[model samples]
Target: MKGYRISLIATAWLATIGVATAYEIDCPTRINIKSDHPELEATPEGWQVSINKNRSLLLTSLGVYSDEPVKLFELKPEIGIIDGKKHDLTWQINSAYDENGNYVKCSYNGEEVQLAKKIDPSMKSCWAIYANDENQHTTAKLICSTSKLQEVE
Candidate 1:
């Protein structure tokens, strides 16, 4: 009976917390983790996220070779998954363009991140850019594809 009770308690806790991979975000620019985790450092190469003493995590723009800075704003418990919890942080790192003018909004989500870009008025393309890294998955990598996105009107 005692063993069964223990099992039930464990199951209940798991349900409430859910799975770590189960957590999702649309644009995860920053990740918030609990204080219990190791120190998070933003190296020039990339971000060295110490999930714990046992493992490490790295968050970088999906790329092979580029010159975009592995942009990191703060170093602390501010964003991402912490103890099966979601901590999402967003910053307008560079909003001068947006302030200068307006463009169509982007819509996409990822496991731990999501970046939305507006449709460039002149280019007639919906380019999604994060920090200095533009969406290079399908585009021409560094340069924003001209007709990748349909013109919205």
Candidate 2:
């Protein structure tokens, strides 16, 4: 009886340890655009930029919030030259309403900020991710607006 109890306790401890050591995958860097824009495209390296008339601008670097199902709504980190100085514009979606709702709350770096001027869910361009320039000269801009995101393998 004593030997059986010891074995059971050992098994339980091992199971607990295994559970504690389990790892979770971090979000990737990608953006999904639901609206129609002739000038914007996602790069092979997982960044979004504008390609207007053969001219391209490095808009932002995308970061994922979830990895399992790969959602489109995630982080936006932008690095570019503003006013002749390099800047990093990064932002994340802090909160948002359900499918029936129409509000999205976001945070830049650590401070709460406003999104773009327009947010219309019915237009399929409702949802957006925003980030501010590190210089503080600019507030926030819409990185990309999408209605939904597809799961990534």
Highest TM-score model number: 2
lDDT of 2 at 78: 42
User: Candidate 2 lDDT, tens digit per residue, 19-79?
Assistant: 2111111112222323344554545686666543332122332232321112334434445
Q: For candidate 2, what is the TM-score?
A: 0.22
Tens digit of lDDT per residue, candidate 1, span 40-105? 464456655555433222234422111121332221212332332233321112233333322222
Models, CA RMSD each: 21.4, 17.8
lDDT accuracy of residue 98 in candidate 1:
37
Report backbone clashes per prediction: 9, 0
